[model samples]
Target: MKADAFPYRAPWWLPGGNAQTLWAALASRRHFGPAPRWQRSRWNTPDGDFVDVDQALHPSAPDAPLLVLFHGLEGSSASQYAVAFADFAAAHGLAYAVPHFRGCSGELNHAPRAYHSGDFAEIDWILRRFASEHPGRPLLAVGVSLGGNALMRWAGELGDAAAQQVRAIASVCSPLDLAAGGHAIGRGFNRLVYTRMFMRSMVPKALKKLEQHPGLFDREALLGARDLYEFDNLFTAPLHGFRDTADYWSRASAKPVLHRIRVPALALNARNDPFVPANSLPTAQDAGTHVTLWQPAQGGHVGFPVSHGPFGLPGHVRAMPEAVGHWLLTHL
Candidate 1:
C-alpha cells in the first residue's frame, strides 16, 4: 500500500553493505529442491535480431499464473536470482520465463542496437506476447537490477493505459535513478571491483559486436573504457541512438516517471545496496498511488540475506524467495 520496510532482517553474519551485495553473487550455496526443467525458445524482435527465453513450465497447471522475469545487466538465465526465482515459481505451480537481453544469451545481437537500462520496448513486447499466447492466465513480472529499471520505466510510461493483462510488477535492487546508480558504481572500490567484473564480460562482447560493424566505433578509444559511464558513452548511447552517456542515463532512468504507474507495482531496494544509494530511492509520496517502494535496511545490490536454520542449510538465500512468495500470495 505504501513504501515501507518489507519485513526482512539482515543477519548479523552478513556484515557491511558490500558483503551482503557480494555474498549471494559469490556464495556457492546449493538450491534445496528438484531442479527446474526449462525450454529454450527465441523471440525474434521487430528487427532482424532475436532475443532468447528460458521457460520453466508449470507441471500441472497450464492456466496458472505466468511470471516473466528479466535479468540485470550481463545476467541471463544462469544468474543466481533468475534460477532461484524460476525454481520458486515452478515449484509453486507457476510458469516462468526469463528473457535474455539483446546479446546476453551467449549470442551477439543484431548491430546498431543493444540493450540499455530503459529498454521498455522488448519488455512491452514480452508482456503482450505472453498474454496473447496464454489467453486467460494471470501475468506478473519480476526484474532484477537493470531489468528492474527497465520494468519500472515501462510501467510508468504506460500509466493508466498500461496493460490490464499484467496484474502486478516487482523490481528488486533496481537503480531507478540511472544517474545516481552510475555515480555510485563509478567511485571508490566499487569502481575498482564491480566495474572491472562487469567489463570483463562486457568488453569482449562489445569487441565481438564491433567485428560485425567494423570501423563504426573508435577502435582504441572504445576499447579503453574504464568504467560504466565510459562504456555507455562509447557504446550503448551511440549504438542505441542516445546523444551520449549523460543523456542516456538521464532519459533512461525510471525515477521521474514512478508517479505515473497505474498498476500495483512494488520497487524493492536495499537502502545499503552497493550500486544504488539510499537517497536515490523514492518515498511513498514520491512514488504515487500505484507503486509501493520497499526499502529494506541492508540488502546489498541484489542481495537480501537472512539467517539460516540451525544447520545453516539454505542460509539467507531463502530470504528473497520467501519475501517474493509472500508478496505474490497476497497480491495474487
Candidate 2:
C-alpha cells in the first residue's frame, strides 16, 4: 500500500506524513531473515535482582554509541522486531542492548510483580547502572510498543535529571493513552484477537505468579475476565495498587507527560493502528520542543514490513535503529 494513502494524512487533528511511512512499514511485518549474533549478559539492579539482557556489538566498530532497545509486551530478545533492530544497529556500527523485562527473558523473575507499561523506575535503574559501568560512552534508547511507553515515561520523568551520557530516544507504536487504547482493544473483533494473544502470554505468567504467591491474585476475578480491561482490572491494576482499571490507565498513560520531555526524542504511531488510534497522539502544543512526534499512515502496531524483490523487510523496524543511530551521530 502507498504510504500516502493512509488516513492519518487527511489533515486530521493529528498530522501525518512521516507517521504514515512508519505505519505502512509496520503493517507489512517483513522479516529481516536471519538473526544477528549477540551475547547474553545480566545486570544487577539496586533491588538486588538480576535482569537478563542481550548485548550485540556492531560488526564493524568495537566501540560505538550504545542503543538500548526495549521490546513490546511479551516480546523478548528472540522477537523478530528486536532482532531486526539489533541487526540494523549492527549494520550501522551501533551497539545495542535488549533488556528483558522480568519473567520475559526465557525465565520467570524472582518477584511476583511482573513488568508493566509505566515502569520507568526499572529502565532508570538499568540506564544508571549501564552508564556507571560504561562511563563516558554515549547511550540512547529505542522502545517498541509497551516498551515505548516505558521509555517515554522515563524520558519525561527524567527531564534535566536524565543522565548526560544519554543522548536521544525513539518510540514506535506506543499506546500513549493507556485508557483509550485499552478501551479500543476491548471492543469488536479487535477485542477477540488481542485478548486471545495477550492472554496466551499473560494468563500463563499470571498463573505462574499465582502459584508462586497463592494469595496475590483473585482467582475468581481472573477466571471471569473476558477482555483486556477486565484482565488488567482484575490482576494488573490491583497488583500495582491502583484503585481500578481507570486509575491505572490514567496514571500509566504517557500523554500527561509528553510535554515534560526535555531530551530529544521521536515518537512514531500509526493512524490506523488497531491498538492505538491517531487521537492518542500528543498535540504539537503539548509536545515539547525536544520531542518529535512521527505519526505514520500505515504501520499496524509494530508490524512494518516492506517487500524488496523476493525479500521484504519491515520498514519501521528497519528504520528505527538507523533513525536513532543517525540522529545520535548527528545530534548527540
Candidate 2, lDDT over the whole model = 0.73
How many clashes in each structure? 0, 20
* Model 2, C-alpha of 209: deviation from truth (Å): 0.6
* Residue pairs with backbone atoms closer than 3 Å in model 1 (clashes): none
Point to the candidate with the largest TM-score: 1
Worst 10 residues of 2 by lDDT: 1-10
Root-mean-square deviation per candidate: 1.6, 5.2
> What would the per-residue lDDT of candidate 1 be over residues 1-332, giving only the tens digit for each residue?
47464766666778778987787777724245666677989888777788888897547486788888899999988887887786678668788888889899988888567799999887888888888888867888889999999999999998876657588888999999999999999999899999999999988888888888887688698778999999999998998789999999999999899999988788899888889989988877779988877887887888775556785524546568657655755666
lDDT of 2 at 130: 74
Candidate 2 residues 42-71, lDDT tens each?
776666567998887446454567778888
* TM-score between model 2 and native: 0.86
lDDT of each: 0.83, 0.73
